[model samples]
Target: MKSFVFRQFEIRQSADVFRVGTDGVLLGSLADIRNARKVLEVGTGTGLISLMLAQRNPKAEFLGLDINQEAVELTRLNFESSPFHSRLKNIHQDFKTFDTQDKFDAIVTNPPYFEASGSEKDKIARQTVELNFRELISKSSELLSEQGVFSLIIPAESGNDFMKMAQENHLFLIRQIHIKGIEGSKNKRLILEFSLTEKALEESEFIIEKSPRQYSDPYLELTKEFHVFKNRS
Candidate 1:
């Protein structure tokens, strides 16, 4: 297990299914949140995305949901200890089963995508987090307010499939940022922002590092607000 302490939040994670990784960070930073007034984080592992959303939109309120009891407790503790505690709340329940009368201006998730072939841990994690593309899109569409955005990160291979599902559910791709570990490498992550309104926007790519030891300028600039040494060479 390893932990990362950022200026505003902390992640205690394992190589296990629930670990918080760079993909989540990329999605949280890439999400266009300046206009969001209310946010929902569907699978807030350690409350990282919720905290990031709160950091960027100080006036916004965040609701973080997770099915795992440990994760829920940890997120609650993390939120209370954080400087933005007043703006964040955590719910310990499966998103599918949780009932909320409110609609959010933004919904963000770092969805679990690996189809479980075997292993108990993998199976449980997938069941709790990963969802079929159709179900995810339809359910998210049901939850999102009209003209609201659904932002998420998932495996790059699933991008087009998820986008098709999103389209069928009346969600339009507003912005997309593909991410790779370094130059000329295969893209591993897709950060997506979808809206009900059809609006023209730019599409781009983000390389996290130029090489193993060198962080990309775009990555640093996007995350500099919360990650210390983000701009340091």
Candidate 2:
């Protein structure tokens, strides 16, 4: 087991499951969760996002859903050992077939982005083998409450198509943040927030590093609470 220690909780990632990464941490730290009582994390690998959000929104209850049994069990353990264990739950079920009468105030995901090209496990983790963007958007729209918000981080190139799909499902873009590897790098990822109602989009850009291995000030500020060495000089 590989363990990652954050300021509030520790996450242990099993060798066979999806490991915690910057994308997950970014979505977890940046997603808006204010006044959200019921939150759901789709494809919650190792439960990292849920734990982070739980720390931010102390009153929210989190449900982590994953299709892989091993991933679900690993997430369960991670949640159980966290300080917010009482407010977190994990279920092993494919998002496409997951049936829930209860709706969510907020839903977040760091979904698969690439086409199939790697090993079986890697293909499932990276490719849309289990869940594609269209299905994810449609299903999430149905699961969201009237005032619900859906937050996600995806490849920057797929933004236009994703926004089209979201609009088809009656989900409108409310906020967008483009992520770059460094100050001069091209945008690589997009952090987006959508809602049921159409609103003027709030857009911004974030750079992870000012140079190789040098964390940008904005990145450090956003993740300062969770990263122990964010202030390294």
Candidate 3:
């Protein structure tokens, strides 16, 4: 298990169930949720994004779904123990199989990106529960209401493929934020927001750090609530 103790919340997550990482935090902070009423978090492994959104948007109701029973249980516990408990609900089910009559105002997810470097012994639940980039985009297109937004954090290398899939799904890119870990390091993640309404795409780059263990102000501002290191500086 991995433990993350933030200033306002504590998260206990499994190593296999896509541990709450920098990508998740980036997506949560950068996603636009000003007018969101109902939000869906697909594959909410530890309810990290759900909880974050709940705190960020007090008026929004969040529904988090996960394929693994253990993960759902963990998320439930986390929600109950969190300050945003009233706004959060966790369900144990796969996003593809979960039935919903109502469409959401916003959908956010930190999906699993299967890399060749992962080991076979890695938790099967994590690998199997993840929806591919194409799957997430297409599914979000179906579940999001008109003018609704879908925000996602994925490997930077896969941004082109994801954008293509979004276009194929009739979802237009509203914003794209390329995230780099450090000054000289390769871009590691991409934070994207999509909607049905066609609009000029807004793009920007975010560097997480200046050097090893030296975080940038933007990174610190976005992650101040979750990273202890951000507060220590």
Q: For residues 1-233, write the lDDT of model 1, one tens digit per residue.
A: 66778877776554443666677777777787788888888877678888877888889999888777777877887788788899999888777766778888898888767775666664544543355556667778888888789998888898998888888888999998888989889998888889988999669888999888788888888888878783344
Per-residue CA lDDT of model 2 for 1-233, tens digit only, reads 76999998998887788898999999999999997999999988889999999999999999999988888998998999999999999998899998989999999999998876656765566789899999999999999998889999999999999999998889999999999989999999999999997889999999999999888989999988898883335
Q: State in Å the error of residue 156, model 2.
A: 0.4
Candidate ranking under lDDT, highest first, comes to: 2, 3, 1
Candidate 2 structure lDDT: 0.92
Candidate 1, position 227, lDDT:
84
| Cα lDDT computed for each candidate against the true fold | 0.79, 0.92, 0.83
The ten-residue window of minimal lDDT in model 1 covers 122-131
Tens digits of lDDT, candidate 3, 53-129: 88789999999988778788889988999998988998888777778788999999877776434566444333433
Best of the candidates, lDDT = 2
Angstrom error of the Cα, residue 15, model 3: value is 3.9
Model 2 stretches with alpha carbons more than 4 Å out: 230-233
| Candidate 2: residue 184 Cα off by (Å) | 1.1
